[model samples]
Target: MVEFTDWDIFRNLALAARWTVLLSIIAFIGGGVVAGILLLLRMTKNVLLVGLVRVYTEVFQGTPLLMQLFLAFFGLSLLGIDIGAWTAASLAMTLFTSAYLCEIWRGCIDSLPKGQWEASRTLGLNYFQTMRYVIVPQSVRVATAPTMGFSVQVVKNTALASIIGFVELTKAGTMLNNATFEPFKVFSLVALFYFAICYPLTRYSKYLERKLNVAG
Candidate 1:
């Protein structure tokens, strides 16, 4: 068995933590772009487009992410498409994030006063123009807190990536524990590392929520 000191284990966990942060950013950014497009489609009067977005969101949100990752990694490989674990994990996360974000922003859009929509129409703005110049700007302010809150969820979800043999923080912790025979010590550090990354995000989300008070 390879023996590892506390410092050595912590160092390795920290290094892997960087990958967790990187993947979270990737998933959130990619998801946001995709979700934005979906939201636009939903706002339009296209029945088919709205139904498709609804179904896409339902599929992702209805299922557990762990299963999604498994399908992306192992199931895809079974189809003779050899994708790397990192690629699979990232893509799965992006899709998952997009679904949730689209739903969240849809709610934000709905929260807008009916008068605002009517006023935009009276002002001769097309649907896309209204959303682009007016609705989205205001909805985005309302969406910010919840979106940031969801980002914390995205970061936490990165731990699941370890199951696919991704050497993110959780995987690194598991490896270190196995080598050192120190599950408690190692896992405690793992929890701490996750907190270090997520706590600030949680707090900031809360702050944004209070500041916007869009509900009121």
Candidate 2:
């Protein structure tokens, strides 16, 4: 076995962190697009769409993210579509993130006073116009913190992607450990790297909560 140095471990893990970040970004964008549509569906008075979205939200939110990844991995392959680990991980995370984000945004939109909607309509605006021009702008302030905070969860959840053969940060660390036989130091660094990525976002989430409270 080739001897591994601290720099060697750092180099490999840092390289893998790129995928972790990239996967998170793709999932963020994909989930946001899907969530936007769901938010629109949620805003409507259509009982069927609202109920459909409710079930969609419940199914994804209720299930473990790990199962989602597994299905995307082995489950899809069983159907004769041989996808890569990256594709599988991305699909799983996108669906998982979308479900949570839909609810978060729906709550933000719901929290707005009915008068905002009434006033917009009173100004000759239609439903879409009211949401786009008036309601969405205000709800953005309410949504910003939770949206960002959930991003942290999105990043952390990528760790689970390793179970589906994604060579992300966690899997890279495990590989390094097997090579160097240094589980303690290897995994400790993994934890720190995750904290380094997530801690600031968490603090900022709390900061936004306070700011919004004061604004309210």
lDDT (CA) for every model shown? 0.93, 0.92
Question: Tens digits of per-residue lDDT for model 2 on 3-48?
Answer: 9999989889889988988999999999999999998887679999
Error of 2 at 143 (Å): 0.3
Clashes of each: 0, 0
Q: Weakest 10 consecutive residues, lDDT, candidate 1? A: 1-10
RMSD of each: 1.1, 1.5
RMSD of 1: 1.1
